[model samples]
Target: MKTINRFFVVLAIALLLSNTSTIAQEQTRPEFVTITTMHWNMDNKDFKMEDWKAVEKEFLDKITMKNEYIAASSFYLHRMTPDNTEVVYVQSYPSWEAIGEAAKRNAELAKTAWPDENARKAFFKKRDAYYSPMHSDEIYATMPNAKTMTAKPTKDMICYVRKGHFAYGEGADEEFDATSKEYFDNVTNKNEFVKAYYPMAHAWGSDRTEFLEAFFFDSMADLESMFDRDTELFEAHWKDEASRKSMGEKGAKYFDNRHGDYIYTYVAGLAK
Candidate 1:
Protein backbone atom coordinates (compact mmCIF):
# COMPACT_ATOMS: atom_id res chain seq x y z
CA MET A 1 0.00 0.00 0.00
CA LYS A 2 2.81 2.42 0.87
CA THR A 3 4.59 1.79 -2.50
CA ILE A 4 1.38 2.25 -4.46
CA ASN A 5 0.65 5.57 -2.76
CA ARG A 6 4.21 6.74 -3.46
CA PHE A 7 3.85 5.87 -7.14
CA PHE A 8 0.68 7.99 -7.51
CA VAL A 9 2.33 10.94 -5.76
CA VAL A 10 5.32 10.80 -8.09
CA LEU A 11 3.00 10.61 -11.14
CA ALA A 12 1.02 13.69 -10.03
CA ILE A 13 4.19 15.65 -9.47
CA ALA A 14 5.53 14.69 -12.89
CA LEU A 15 2.32 15.79 -14.60
CA LEU A 16 2.41 19.14 -12.79
CA LEU A 17 6.00 19.68 -13.83
CA SER A 18 5.16 18.91 -17.48
CA ASN A 19 2.28 21.38 -17.50
CA THR A 20 4.46 24.09 -15.95
CA SER A 21 7.17 23.58 -18.55
CA THR A 22 4.66 23.89 -21.36
CA ILE A 23 3.35 27.20 -20.01
CA ALA A 24 6.87 28.61 -19.68
CA GLN A 25 7.75 27.64 -23.24
CA GLU A 26 4.71 29.43 -24.56
CA GLN A 27 5.57 32.58 -22.60
CA THR A 28 9.17 32.70 -23.83
CA ARG A 29 8.48 32.24 -27.53
CA PRO A 30 9.86 35.22 -29.46
CA GLU A 31 7.49 37.88 -30.84
CA PHE A 32 8.29 40.09 -33.84
CA VAL A 33 7.56 43.66 -34.97
CA THR A 34 7.79 44.38 -38.70
CA ILE A 35 8.83 47.84 -39.88
CA THR A 36 8.29 48.59 -43.56
CA THR A 37 9.60 51.68 -45.33
CA MET A 38 7.97 52.61 -48.65
CA HIS A 39 9.87 54.87 -50.99
CA TRP A 40 9.84 56.00 -54.67
CA ASN A 41 12.45 55.77 -57.40
CA MET A 42 14.47 58.88 -58.09
CA ASP A 43 13.61 60.43 -61.43
CA ASN A 44 15.55 58.71 -64.22
CA LYS A 45 16.95 62.04 -65.35
CA ASP A 46 18.39 63.08 -61.97
CA PHE A 47 19.53 59.73 -60.62
CA LYS A 48 20.95 56.92 -62.73
CA MET A 49 19.25 53.55 -62.20
CA GLU A 50 22.61 51.85 -61.60
CA ASP A 51 23.17 53.99 -58.52
CA TRP A 52 20.53 52.00 -56.65
CA LYS A 53 22.89 49.10 -56.15
CA ALA A 54 25.51 51.35 -54.62
CA VAL A 55 22.98 52.89 -52.22
CA GLU A 56 21.71 49.49 -51.17
CA LYS A 57 25.22 48.18 -50.68
CA GLU A 58 26.19 51.18 -48.59
CA PHE A 59 23.14 50.70 -46.37
CA LEU A 60 23.90 47.03 -45.81
CA ASP A 61 27.63 47.51 -45.36
CA LYS A 62 27.61 50.80 -43.47
CA ILE A 63 24.35 51.32 -41.58
CA THR A 64 23.07 47.82 -40.88
CA MET A 65 26.53 46.34 -40.43
CA LYS A 66 27.19 48.36 -37.30
CA ASN A 67 23.68 48.48 -35.90
CA GLU A 68 22.90 46.02 -33.10
CA TYR A 69 19.25 46.97 -32.77
CA ILE A 70 18.27 45.22 -35.98
CA ALA A 71 17.71 41.50 -35.61
CA ALA A 72 17.29 41.02 -39.38
CA SER A 73 16.83 43.17 -42.48
CA SER A 74 15.89 42.81 -46.17
CA PHE A 75 15.78 45.18 -49.14
CA TYR A 76 13.45 44.81 -52.13
CA LEU A 77 13.06 46.43 -55.54
CA HIS A 78 9.46 46.30 -56.75
CA ARG A 79 8.82 44.20 -59.86
CA MET A 80 5.19 45.10 -60.45
CA THR A 81 3.92 47.40 -63.25
CA PRO A 82 3.82 51.25 -63.64
CA ASP A 83 4.79 51.42 -59.97
CA ASN A 84 8.42 50.78 -61.01
CA THR A 85 9.27 51.60 -57.41
CA GLU A 86 12.86 51.32 -56.16
CA VAL A 87 13.10 49.93 -52.66
CA VAL A 88 11.31 48.40 -49.71
CA TYR A 89 13.33 48.24 -46.48
CA VAL A 90 11.96 45.69 -44.00
CA GLN A 91 13.45 45.30 -40.55
CA SER A 92 12.24 43.19 -37.63
CA TYR A 93 12.42 43.94 -33.92
CA PRO A 94 11.89 41.68 -30.92
CA SER A 95 9.26 43.95 -29.39
CA TRP A 96 7.53 47.30 -29.94
CA GLU A 97 9.75 49.08 -27.42
CA ALA A 98 12.78 47.74 -29.20
CA ILE A 99 11.60 49.43 -32.37
CA GLY A 100 11.96 52.89 -30.86
CA GLU A 101 15.19 52.02 -29.13
CA ALA A 102 16.63 50.64 -32.34
CA ALA A 103 15.95 53.88 -34.20
CA LYS A 104 17.62 55.88 -31.46
CA ARG A 105 20.61 53.58 -31.46
CA ASN A 106 20.94 53.75 -35.23
CA ALA A 107 20.94 57.54 -35.10
CA GLU A 108 23.63 57.47 -32.44
CA LEU A 109 25.70 55.06 -34.45
CA ALA A 110 25.37 57.21 -37.53
CA LYS A 111 26.67 60.21 -35.59
CA THR A 112 29.60 58.25 -34.22
CA ALA A 113 30.47 56.78 -37.59
CA TRP A 114 30.39 60.19 -39.22
CA PRO A 115 31.87 62.59 -36.74
CA ASP A 116 31.90 65.35 -39.34
CA GLU A 117 28.44 66.94 -39.43
CA ASN A 118 28.83 67.97 -43.07
CA ALA A 119 29.94 64.49 -44.13
CA ARG A 120 26.98 62.90 -42.32
CA LYS A 121 24.64 65.33 -44.03
CA ALA A 122 26.15 64.52 -47.40
CA PHE A 123 25.90 60.80 -46.74
CA PHE A 124 22.16 60.97 -46.10
CA LYS A 125 21.67 63.36 -49.00
CA LYS A 126 23.36 60.92 -51.36
CA ARG A 127 21.61 57.95 -49.79
CA ASP A 128 18.17 59.51 -50.21
CA ALA A 129 18.51 59.53 -54.02
CA TYR A 130 17.70 55.84 -54.60
CA TYR A 131 13.90 55.84 -54.22
CA SER A 132 10.69 57.75 -54.79
CA PRO A 133 10.36 61.35 -53.68
CA MET A 134 8.04 60.33 -50.82
CA HIS A 135 7.50 57.34 -48.52
CA SER A 136 5.55 55.92 -45.54
CA ASP A 137 5.73 53.19 -42.90
CA GLU A 138 3.32 50.63 -41.38
CA ILE A 139 4.18 48.93 -38.08
CA TYR A 140 2.62 45.59 -37.17
CA ALA A 141 2.40 43.53 -33.98
CA THR A 142 2.47 39.78 -34.58
CA MET A 143 -0.44 37.48 -33.72
CA PRO A 144 -0.18 34.36 -31.53
CA ASN A 145 -2.61 31.83 -33.05
CA ALA A 146 -2.31 32.07 -36.85
CA LYS A 147 -1.04 29.44 -39.32
CA THR A 148 2.26 30.18 -41.05
CA MET A 149 2.59 28.84 -44.64
CA THR A 150 5.22 26.37 -45.82
CA ALA A 151 6.26 27.67 -49.26
CA LYS A 152 8.96 30.33 -49.24
CA PRO A 153 7.88 33.84 -50.22
CA THR A 154 9.60 35.02 -53.43
CA LYS A 155 10.16 38.33 -51.66
CA ASP A 156 9.27 38.28 -47.95
CA MET A 157 7.40 35.55 -46.15
CA ILE A 158 3.72 35.44 -47.13
CA CYS A 159 2.08 38.70 -46.01
CA TYR A 160 -1.47 39.85 -46.60
CA VAL A 161 -1.86 43.57 -47.28
CA ARG A 162 -5.15 44.95 -45.99
CA LYS A 163 -5.61 48.51 -47.28
CA GLY A 164 -8.16 50.81 -45.72
CA HIS A 165 -9.29 54.29 -46.67
CA PHE A 166 -10.77 56.83 -44.31
CA ALA A 167 -13.45 59.36 -45.22
CA TYR A 168 -12.07 62.82 -45.99
CA GLY A 169 -11.79 65.02 -42.89
CA GLU A 170 -12.32 62.01 -40.61
CA GLY A 171 -9.89 60.91 -37.94
CA ALA A 172 -8.51 57.39 -38.39
CA ASP A 173 -8.37 56.53 -34.71
CA GLU A 174 -12.06 55.70 -34.36
CA GLU A 175 -12.40 53.98 -37.73
CA PHE A 176 -9.27 51.99 -37.06
CA ASP A 177 -10.66 50.76 -33.76
CA ALA A 178 -13.92 49.67 -35.36
CA THR A 179 -12.34 48.02 -38.39
CA SER A 180 -9.63 46.30 -36.32
CA LYS A 181 -12.25 44.83 -34.01
CA GLU A 182 -14.25 43.66 -37.02
CA TYR A 183 -11.18 41.95 -38.46
CA PHE A 184 -10.18 40.23 -35.21
CA ASP A 185 -13.60 39.37 -33.79
CA ASN A 186 -15.27 38.54 -37.06
CA VAL A 187 -12.88 37.87 -39.99
CA THR A 188 -9.87 36.16 -38.45
CA ASN A 189 -11.88 34.08 -36.00
CA LYS A 190 -14.05 32.72 -38.79
CA ASN A 191 -11.29 32.14 -41.37
CA GLU A 192 -8.66 29.49 -40.72
CA PHE A 193 -6.25 30.80 -43.42
CA VAL A 194 -5.48 33.82 -41.31
CA LYS A 195 -2.34 32.74 -39.47
CA ALA A 196 -1.92 36.18 -37.92
CA TYR A 197 -3.04 39.77 -38.61
CA TYR A 198 -1.48 43.09 -37.64
CA PRO A 199 -2.84 46.63 -37.94
CA MET A 200 -0.70 49.70 -38.76
CA ALA A 201 -1.39 53.38 -39.26
CA HIS A 202 0.36 56.14 -41.22
CA ALA A 203 2.19 57.71 -38.30
CA TRP A 204 4.42 59.90 -40.47
CA GLY A 205 5.10 60.58 -44.14
CA SER A 206 2.70 59.79 -47.01
CA ASP A 207 -0.42 61.70 -47.90
CA ARG A 208 -2.99 58.93 -48.08
CA THR A 209 -5.54 58.54 -45.30
CA GLU A 210 -4.76 54.87 -45.10
CA PHE A 211 -4.26 52.07 -42.60
CA LEU A 212 -2.51 48.79 -43.37
CA GLU A 213 -3.53 45.35 -42.20
CA ALA A 214 -0.79 42.75 -42.60
CA PHE A 215 -1.50 39.03 -42.68
CA PHE A 216 1.12 36.28 -42.78
CA PHE A 217 0.90 33.08 -44.79
CA ASP A 218 3.20 30.14 -45.51
CA SER A 219 3.46 30.53 -49.29
CA MET A 220 2.51 32.62 -52.32
CA ALA A 221 0.07 29.98 -53.51
CA ASP A 222 -1.63 30.04 -50.15
CA LEU A 223 -1.85 33.84 -50.39
CA GLU A 224 -3.62 33.60 -53.75
CA SER A 225 -6.10 31.05 -52.43
CA MET A 226 -6.85 33.18 -49.39
CA PHE A 227 -8.22 36.00 -51.57
CA ASP A 228 -10.67 33.63 -53.23
CA ARG A 229 -11.76 32.46 -49.83
CA ASP A 230 -11.97 36.02 -48.54
CA THR A 231 -14.13 37.02 -51.48
CA GLU A 232 -16.53 34.21 -50.72
CA LEU A 233 -16.60 35.21 -47.08
CA PHE A 234 -17.22 38.83 -48.00
CA GLU A 235 -20.13 37.86 -50.21
CA ALA A 236 -21.69 35.75 -47.54
CA HIS A 237 -21.32 38.34 -44.83
CA TRP A 238 -22.22 41.39 -46.90
CA LYS A 239 -24.84 39.79 -49.11
CA ASP A 240 -26.20 42.95 -50.73
CA GLU A 241 -24.02 43.97 -53.64
CA ALA A 242 -25.45 47.47 -53.63
CA SER A 243 -24.67 47.87 -49.96
CA ARG A 244 -21.13 46.65 -50.46
CA LYS A 245 -20.57 48.91 -53.44
CA SER A 246 -21.88 51.89 -51.53
CA MET A 247 -19.54 51.14 -48.62
CA GLY A 248 -16.59 50.91 -51.02
CA GLU A 249 -17.54 54.21 -52.59
CA LYS A 250 -17.68 55.80 -49.17
CA GLY A 251 -14.20 54.52 -48.45
CA ALA A 252 -12.95 55.86 -51.75
CA LYS A 253 -13.86 59.46 -50.96
CA TYR A 254 -11.27 59.62 -48.18
CA PHE A 255 -8.28 59.06 -50.39
CA ASP A 256 -6.77 60.89 -53.32
CA ASN A 257 -4.79 57.80 -54.31
CA ARG A 258 -5.12 54.05 -54.12
CA HIS A 259 -3.33 52.14 -51.36
CA GLY A 260 -0.01 50.52 -52.27
CA ASP A 261 1.10 46.94 -51.63
CA TYR A 262 4.18 44.72 -51.77
CA ILE A 263 4.65 41.03 -50.97
CA TYR A 264 8.13 40.49 -49.58
CA THR A 265 9.88 37.78 -47.53
CA TYR A 266 11.44 38.01 -44.10
CA VAL A 267 15.22 38.28 -44.01
CA ALA A 268 16.25 35.87 -41.27
CA GLY A 269 18.11 37.43 -38.29
CA LEU A 270 16.61 40.69 -39.58
CA ALA A 271 13.30 39.81 -37.96
CA LYS A 272 13.15 39.83 -34.20
Candidate 2:
Protein backbone atom coordinates (compact mmCIF):
# COMPACT_ATOMS: atom_id res chain seq x y z
CA MET A 1 0.00 0.00 0.00
CA LYS A 2 2.86 2.42 0.80
CA THR A 3 4.60 1.79 -2.58
CA ILE A 4 1.35 2.47 -4.54
CA ASN A 5 0.79 5.80 -2.76
CA ARG A 6 4.35 6.97 -3.58
CA PHE A 7 3.92 6.07 -7.28
CA PHE A 8 0.65 8.09 -7.54
CA VAL A 9 2.26 11.13 -5.95
CA VAL A 10 5.14 11.03 -8.46
CA LEU A 11 2.69 10.81 -11.39
CA ALA A 12 0.78 13.87 -10.21
CA ILE A 13 3.97 15.93 -9.95
CA ALA A 14 5.06 14.91 -13.46
CA LEU A 15 1.67 15.97 -14.95
CA LEU A 16 1.92 19.37 -13.28
CA LEU A 17 5.43 19.96 -14.67
CA SER A 18 4.31 19.00 -18.19
CA ASN A 19 1.42 21.45 -18.07
CA THR A 20 3.71 24.24 -16.88
CA SER A 21 6.16 23.63 -19.73
CA THR A 22 3.37 23.82 -22.33
CA ILE A 23 2.07 27.10 -20.94
CA ALA A 24 5.51 28.70 -21.07
CA GLN A 25 5.94 27.75 -24.70
CA GLU A 26 2.59 29.28 -25.61
CA GLN A 27 3.41 32.56 -23.90
CA THR A 28 6.86 32.99 -25.43
CA ARG A 29 5.89 32.76 -29.10
CA PRO A 30 7.38 35.68 -31.06
CA GLU A 31 5.64 38.16 -33.36
CA PHE A 32 6.68 37.84 -37.01
CA VAL A 33 7.37 40.55 -39.68
CA THR A 34 8.16 40.35 -43.37
CA ILE A 35 10.03 42.99 -45.37
CA THR A 36 10.60 43.19 -49.12
CA THR A 37 12.91 45.76 -50.64
CA MET A 38 12.81 46.49 -54.34
CA HIS A 39 13.97 49.13 -56.76
CA TRP A 40 12.29 50.77 -59.73
CA ASN A 41 13.15 49.49 -63.23
CA MET A 42 14.34 52.82 -64.53
CA ASP A 43 15.37 51.30 -67.85
CA ASN A 44 11.75 50.48 -68.61
CA LYS A 45 10.92 53.60 -70.56
CA ASP A 46 7.30 52.47 -71.09
CA PHE A 47 6.64 52.56 -67.34
CA LYS A 48 4.24 55.30 -66.28
CA MET A 49 4.47 56.69 -62.75
CA GLU A 50 0.78 57.48 -62.46
CA ASP A 51 -0.25 53.99 -63.62
CA TRP A 52 2.08 52.38 -61.08
CA LYS A 53 0.68 54.62 -58.38
CA ALA A 54 -2.77 53.40 -59.30
CA VAL A 55 -1.61 49.80 -58.88
CA GLU A 56 -0.29 50.59 -55.41
CA LYS A 57 -3.53 52.36 -54.55
CA GLU A 58 -5.40 49.18 -55.46
CA PHE A 59 -3.46 47.23 -52.86
CA LEU A 60 -3.66 49.93 -50.18
CA ASP A 61 -7.31 50.83 -50.74
CA LYS A 62 -8.75 47.38 -51.33
CA ILE A 63 -6.46 44.39 -50.79
CA THR A 64 -4.93 45.32 -47.44
CA MET A 65 -8.21 46.63 -46.07
CA LYS A 66 -10.08 43.48 -47.09
CA ASN A 67 -7.51 41.01 -45.72
CA GLU A 68 -8.13 40.00 -42.12
CA TYR A 69 -4.80 38.19 -41.74
CA ILE A 70 -2.63 41.23 -42.50
CA ALA A 71 -2.21 43.11 -39.24
CA ALA A 72 -0.47 46.13 -40.82
CA SER A 73 1.22 47.20 -44.05
CA SER A 74 3.48 50.17 -44.80
CA PHE A 75 5.52 51.58 -47.66
CA TYR A 76 8.85 53.36 -47.58
CA LEU A 77 11.16 55.19 -49.97
CA HIS A 78 14.91 55.12 -49.68
CA ARG A 79 16.36 58.40 -48.37
CA MET A 80 20.06 59.22 -47.93
CA THR A 81 21.08 55.83 -49.30
CA PRO A 82 23.01 54.61 -52.36
CA ASP A 83 19.87 52.98 -53.68
CA ASN A 84 17.96 56.14 -54.46
CA THR A 85 15.30 54.31 -56.48
CA GLU A 86 14.60 51.65 -53.89
CA VAL A 87 11.20 51.13 -52.30
CA VAL A 88 10.45 49.01 -49.27
CA TYR A 89 7.24 47.23 -48.36
CA VAL A 90 6.72 45.89 -44.87
CA GLN A 91 3.90 43.80 -43.43
CA SER A 92 3.35 42.60 -39.88
CA TYR A 93 1.71 39.33 -38.93
CA PRO A 94 0.44 37.72 -35.73
CA SER A 95 2.06 34.40 -36.67
CA TRP A 96 3.95 32.73 -39.53
CA GLU A 97 0.75 31.02 -40.63
CA ALA A 98 -0.81 34.42 -41.21
CA ILE A 99 1.73 35.19 -43.96
CA GLY A 100 0.47 32.35 -46.12
CA GLU A 101 -3.15 33.37 -45.56
CA ALA A 102 -2.37 36.96 -46.49
CA ALA A 103 -0.74 35.92 -49.75
CA LYS A 104 -3.75 33.78 -50.69
CA ARG A 105 -6.11 36.62 -49.93
CA ASN A 106 -4.04 39.07 -51.99
CA ALA A 107 -4.26 36.79 -55.02
CA GLU A 108 -8.01 36.54 -54.62
CA LEU A 109 -8.29 40.31 -54.37
CA ALA A 110 -6.25 40.77 -57.54
CA LYS A 111 -8.64 38.58 -59.48
CA THR A 112 -11.62 40.49 -58.14
CA ALA A 113 -10.00 43.79 -59.07
CA TRP A 114 -9.64 42.71 -62.68
CA PRO A 115 -12.30 40.21 -63.62
CA ASP A 116 -11.24 39.76 -67.24
CA GLU A 117 -8.13 37.61 -67.67
CA ASN A 118 -6.79 39.81 -70.47
CA ALA A 119 -7.25 42.97 -68.43
CA ARG A 120 -5.61 41.27 -65.42
CA LYS A 121 -2.58 40.33 -67.52
CA ALA A 122 -2.19 43.86 -68.89
CA PHE A 123 -2.58 45.46 -65.47
CA PHE A 124 -0.02 43.19 -63.81
CA LYS A 125 2.40 43.63 -66.70
CA LYS A 126 2.30 47.38 -66.32
CA ARG A 127 2.70 47.06 -62.55
CA ASP A 128 5.58 44.64 -62.98
CA ALA A 129 7.36 47.01 -65.32
CA TYR A 130 7.65 49.55 -62.55
CA TYR A 131 9.64 47.21 -60.27
CA SER A 132 12.85 45.39 -60.93
CA PRO A 133 12.76 41.60 -61.02
CA MET A 134 15.49 41.38 -58.38
CA HIS A 135 14.49 42.12 -54.79
CA SER A 136 15.43 41.03 -51.27
CA ASP A 137 13.17 39.48 -48.64
CA GLU A 138 13.75 39.33 -44.91
CA ILE A 139 11.90 38.00 -41.88
CA TYR A 140 12.30 39.21 -38.31
CA ALA A 141 10.91 38.52 -34.85
CA THR A 142 10.01 41.77 -33.03
CA MET A 143 11.05 42.12 -29.41
CA PRO A 144 8.41 42.89 -26.79
CA ASN A 145 10.25 45.83 -25.16
CA ALA A 146 9.83 48.21 -28.12
CA LYS A 147 9.08 51.85 -27.22
CA THR A 148 6.61 53.99 -29.16
CA MET A 149 6.03 57.68 -28.46
CA THR A 150 2.52 57.44 -29.85
CA ALA A 151 0.08 54.65 -30.63
CA LYS A 152 0.50 55.19 -34.38
CA PRO A 153 1.42 58.24 -36.38
CA THR A 154 -1.37 60.21 -38.08
CA LYS A 155 1.08 61.51 -40.69
CA ASP A 156 4.14 60.24 -42.55
CA MET A 157 7.28 59.66 -40.47
CA ILE A 158 10.94 59.08 -41.34
CA CYS A 159 12.36 55.61 -40.66
CA TYR A 160 16.02 55.01 -40.06
CA VAL A 161 17.10 51.36 -39.91
CA ARG A 162 20.41 50.13 -38.58
CA LYS A 163 21.31 46.46 -38.92
CA GLY A 164 24.14 44.66 -37.12
CA HIS A 165 25.32 41.08 -37.17
CA PHE A 166 25.51 39.23 -33.83
CA ALA A 167 28.81 37.58 -32.88
CA TYR A 168 28.52 36.68 -29.21
CA GLY A 169 28.31 33.43 -27.24
CA GLU A 170 25.35 31.89 -25.38
CA GLY A 171 26.63 32.88 -21.94
CA ALA A 172 27.33 36.44 -23.12
CA ASP A 173 23.68 37.03 -24.04
CA GLU A 174 22.69 38.07 -20.52
CA GLU A 175 25.63 40.46 -20.11
CA PHE A 176 25.06 42.02 -23.54
CA ASP A 177 21.35 42.47 -22.81
CA ALA A 178 22.10 44.15 -19.47
CA THR A 179 24.48 46.62 -21.06
CA SER A 180 22.02 47.36 -23.87
CA LYS A 181 19.18 47.88 -21.41
CA GLU A 182 21.20 50.57 -19.63
CA TYR A 183 21.82 52.44 -22.88
CA PHE A 184 18.16 52.26 -23.86
CA ASP A 185 16.96 53.48 -20.47
CA ASN A 186 19.40 56.34 -20.17
CA VAL A 187 19.88 57.43 -23.79
CA THR A 188 17.27 56.17 -26.27
CA ASN A 189 14.27 56.53 -23.97
CA LYS A 190 15.23 60.05 -22.97
CA ASN A 191 15.80 61.36 -26.51
CA GLU A 192 12.94 63.64 -27.54
CA PHE A 193 13.80 63.84 -31.24
CA VAL A 194 13.04 60.18 -31.90
CA LYS A 195 9.36 59.38 -32.23
CA ALA A 196 9.65 55.60 -31.70
CA TYR A 197 12.13 52.76 -31.62
CA TYR A 198 11.76 49.08 -32.45
CA PRO A 199 14.36 46.35 -31.96
CA MET A 200 14.04 43.05 -33.81
CA ALA A 201 16.03 39.88 -34.46
CA HIS A 202 16.51 38.12 -37.75
CA ALA A 203 14.34 34.98 -37.48
CA TRP A 204 14.71 33.64 -41.05
CA GLY A 205 17.23 35.08 -43.51
CA SER A 206 20.83 34.84 -44.74
CA ASP A 207 22.11 36.47 -41.55
CA ARG A 208 20.41 34.43 -38.85
CA THR A 209 21.80 36.42 -35.92
CA GLU A 210 21.21 39.93 -37.23
CA PHE A 211 20.00 42.67 -34.92
CA LEU A 212 17.85 45.34 -36.60
CA GLU A 213 16.79 48.63 -35.00
CA ALA A 214 14.31 51.03 -36.55
CA PHE A 215 14.19 54.66 -35.41
CA PHE A 216 11.28 56.87 -36.33
CA PHE A 217 11.23 60.65 -36.76
CA ASP A 218 8.65 63.25 -37.74
CA SER A 219 10.59 64.63 -40.72
CA MET A 220 13.82 64.41 -42.72
CA ALA A 221 15.26 67.29 -40.72
CA ASP A 222 14.32 65.46 -37.52
CA LEU A 223 16.62 62.60 -38.53
CA GLU A 224 19.67 64.79 -38.25
CA SER A 225 18.39 66.32 -35.03
CA MET A 226 17.89 62.84 -33.55
CA PHE A 227 21.53 61.94 -34.14
CA ASP A 228 22.72 65.23 -32.68
CA ARG A 229 20.53 64.71 -29.62
CA ASP A 230 21.83 61.16 -29.23
CA THR A 231 25.39 62.52 -29.07
CA GLU A 232 24.39 64.94 -26.31
CA LEU A 233 22.49 62.26 -24.41
CA PHE A 234 25.42 59.87 -24.59
CA GLU A 235 27.73 62.48 -23.11
CA ALA A 236 25.24 63.28 -20.34
CA HIS A 237 24.51 59.65 -19.49
CA TRP A 238 28.07 58.30 -19.61
CA LYS A 239 29.45 61.44 -17.88
CA ASP A 240 32.96 61.22 -19.39
CA GLU A 241 34.87 60.28 -22.55
CA ALA A 242 36.45 57.22 -20.93
CA SER A 243 33.08 55.80 -19.86
CA ARG A 244 31.63 56.30 -23.34
CA LYS A 245 34.63 54.63 -24.99
CA SER A 246 34.41 51.70 -22.60
CA MET A 247 30.71 51.30 -23.31
CA GLY A 248 31.36 51.33 -27.06
CA GLU A 249 34.06 48.68 -26.72
CA LYS A 250 31.80 46.44 -24.67
CA GLY A 251 28.92 46.82 -27.17
CA ALA A 252 31.20 46.11 -30.16
CA LYS A 253 32.06 42.68 -28.81
CA TYR A 254 28.45 41.52 -29.26
CA PHE A 255 28.26 42.63 -32.90
CA ASP A 256 30.39 42.49 -36.02
CA ASN A 257 32.44 45.51 -37.02
CA ARG A 258 30.42 46.03 -40.20
CA HIS A 259 26.85 47.37 -40.18
CA GLY A 260 24.19 48.36 -42.71
CA ASP A 261 22.23 51.58 -42.45
CA TYR A 262 19.30 52.86 -44.50
CA ILE A 263 16.80 55.70 -44.32
CA TYR A 264 13.14 55.37 -45.34
CA THR A 265 10.09 57.58 -45.37
CA TYR A 266 7.05 55.84 -43.90
CA VAL A 267 3.82 56.52 -45.86
CA ALA A 268 0.91 56.58 -43.47
CA GLY A 269 -1.76 56.70 -46.17
CA LEU A 270 -0.27 53.64 -47.84
CA ALA A 271 -0.40 51.59 -44.63
CA LYS A 272 -3.26 49.42 -43.47
* lDDT computed for candidate 1: 0.50
lDDT of 1 by residue, 137-255 (tens): 65543333233334334444555454544335543434433433343344444555655554444434453355555567666777666655665555565578685564344333334
Which 10 consecutive positions of candidate 1 have the poorest summed lDDT?
8-17
Q: Can you give the TM-score per candidate against the true fold? A: 0.47, 0.78
Each model's lDDT comes to 0.50, 0.69
Superposed on all Cα atoms, model 2 deviates from the true structure by an RMSD in Å of 12.9
Residue-wise C-alpha lDDT for candidate 2, range 137-181, written one tens digit per residue? 999876643566466677878999877666553325445556666
lDDT of 2 at 198: 71
